[model samples]
Target: MGSAAPAFYGRRVPLFFNPLEAAAHRLSIAPPMFDYFNTLGLHALVAAARLRVFDALRERPSTADGLATTLTIDPRTAEVLLRVLAGLGYLRVKGGRYRLTRTSRTWFTTDSPTSLVAGLEFWERTACVIWPRLAEAVRDGSPVTPFYELLESDAALSRSFQAWTAALARRQAPATARIIPVPRDGGHVLDVGGSHGLFSVELLHRHPGLRATVLDLPQALEAAADHPRLTLRAGSFLDDDLGEGYDVALLFNIVHGLDDQEVAKLFARVAAALNPGGAIVIGDQFRDSLMPGRASRTLLDLLDLNYRVATGGRVRDFREVARMLRAAGFDRPRHRRPLRSVVTELAVAVVKSPSRP
Candidate 1:
């Protein structure tokens, strides 16, 4: 059967087909479905390991009954879930005993430095809940999603979120540090929303003279406490005072989460903080509709809806960001396309002189 569905009652139905045809039809729509599947997949994989199924298997391949007793699950249900996971390649079965596959060994190993277990935990614990409200976010024009509001009210949830955010920065910090220029001649850096102080750590490692002030919620300081080169301050970017006279300030992935008015205020603050001849870098997925041969950027416009709903923030297009920079009293914006995703554009705005407030 062809992948395309036939029409019925003003809507196409894939279930009308035979079992093989229905499976093929489902595979045809798997691209969009994969987004939904990714939520459960990563987390489930983590949860299984957390429940000690892998460790149980590590000692020796075990029958489902053995795994169930060790993992505290019912034998019959554990058998079903195990077989499904084995089919999905997380495990393998031989002689009626289940074993962890190589795919599980690489990332699922607790000792692996590059393990994605934290990433999976963040998804299972949060993103899965937030994504269901995408349509509501699109309709409401509000950046704060129900998930964020929930976080504000729930202290435990908020802490989990902060931890996940910090983990993400820590994991990606080395890569970011490699790309960002660290001045050897001695200059301070302002790490805007500097979660975990990864940026500061990486920068200071590269340049001995660089000191950084990480401006974020005080709760975020938990991740930054050990970094000698970083000083953590607690305050909102809009309401808090950003200290004056820095040579280079970084607004990495910060602008995308705020509205135009909020971004304008932030720019004005950043401009005030910079010394004359200083530079401000706005690193984010700056939307570029014209980029040739790249569909990922275009697709990100859809993914950004999650940010909009959950945090009261909106991702910016390149043009929108440039205009905001100019309005905040900066010279023309300079942009660098560092990655294929629209999220990775680094827009640097130069502060030539202090503007009269």
Candidate 2:
């Protein structure tokens, strides 16, 4: 993959401090005044994505009128959208035709392996629904219905969410697989709540002798890949059997959606499902302790709110994660950041003898 996808989201370090937010803080302005929305350019990008404008320009350049004819939209609106896209550097106009920039061609087109189209669609479907209801969540201390429940009821939303998450898993799989302590000779691997199965697939690719199982909801596994070395089990990781005698278990990006009680129970369940001497790798954006305030890790701070709004969950800090692991009968967990993307991290814990307490 190219380097753009990582940077497109954000950087690992803060480039500058925002004195405006500080001024707002001094004046006691509501946080929403600054935090409520993205810049208009981002909203434009999302609109273009949902409209499939990037896909239209993927194969060949087109004038605004030509694109409007192809997409069956008002020519004037199409012209404005194209101009906006071009102005934002995602598109370039030459000889009265518009085309994708190199970064756009690589990461935004549907044909690209690293396409972020699903991500944009997902943002439209999920974030748009979640953010507007954030005040209610903050007030009631929970979403009216959890985001997963909402997804379960709506097929289109569920598919969009899965597609986006799977795209993310594909990009992150390589970076994640490297740090996980999979046994050299290859033993059983369990991927708990591994909805899209890309992580397990990556591990299988790396360790030829490894066999893996992806456990997730039935709806989530519908598009999961079938392989000779892979098994797909459909069920809730919280309330179902996790199967025993696993050498390595992967818990990736699923914890932020869970409550503290649920996390404790799930970790204990996974610990029981693993064989003695097995390792479990937990991956997500843990709350950064050093820079936990609004000035730094801003996305993470937003994500902490996102979790609360979407799932009644909050980002757990490093020490809290280790405490959960230790309470589940594992030793102190070791932390690793394979990609250094600042969006996610890994914590590895080993099961001692007599695996389940």
Per-candidate TM-scores read 0.75, 0.84
Q: In candidate 2, which residue ranges exceed 4 Å CA deviation?
A: 1-43, 87-89, 93-96, 289-296, 340-342, 355-357
Candidate 1 ranges with C-alpha deviation above 4 Å: 1-43, 52-72, 86-110, 114-116, 119-122, 125-129, 144-155, 289-299, 337-345
Q: For candidate 1, list the clashing residue pairs, or say none.
A: 143-312, 144-312, 145-309, 257-313, 284-343, 285-342, 285-343
Tens digits of per-residue lDDT, candidate 2, 20-135, equal: 64455555662433233244656878878777788999867899999888889889988998887776668888988999888677667888877877667557755556677888
Alpha-carbon deviation at 161 in model 2, angstroms: 0.7
lDDT digits (tens) for residues 43-141 of candidate 1: 567667677776678677899999888778989978987776675577888999898777666555554443444455545654557666667767877
Supply candidate 1's per-residue lDDT for 95: 92
Report model 2's TM-score to 2 decimal places: 0.84
Give the distance in Å from residue 231's predicted Cα in candidate 2 to where it truly belongs. 0.5
lDDT leader:
2
Estimate the lDDT of model 2: 0.78
User: In TM-score terms, which candidate is top?
Assistant: 2
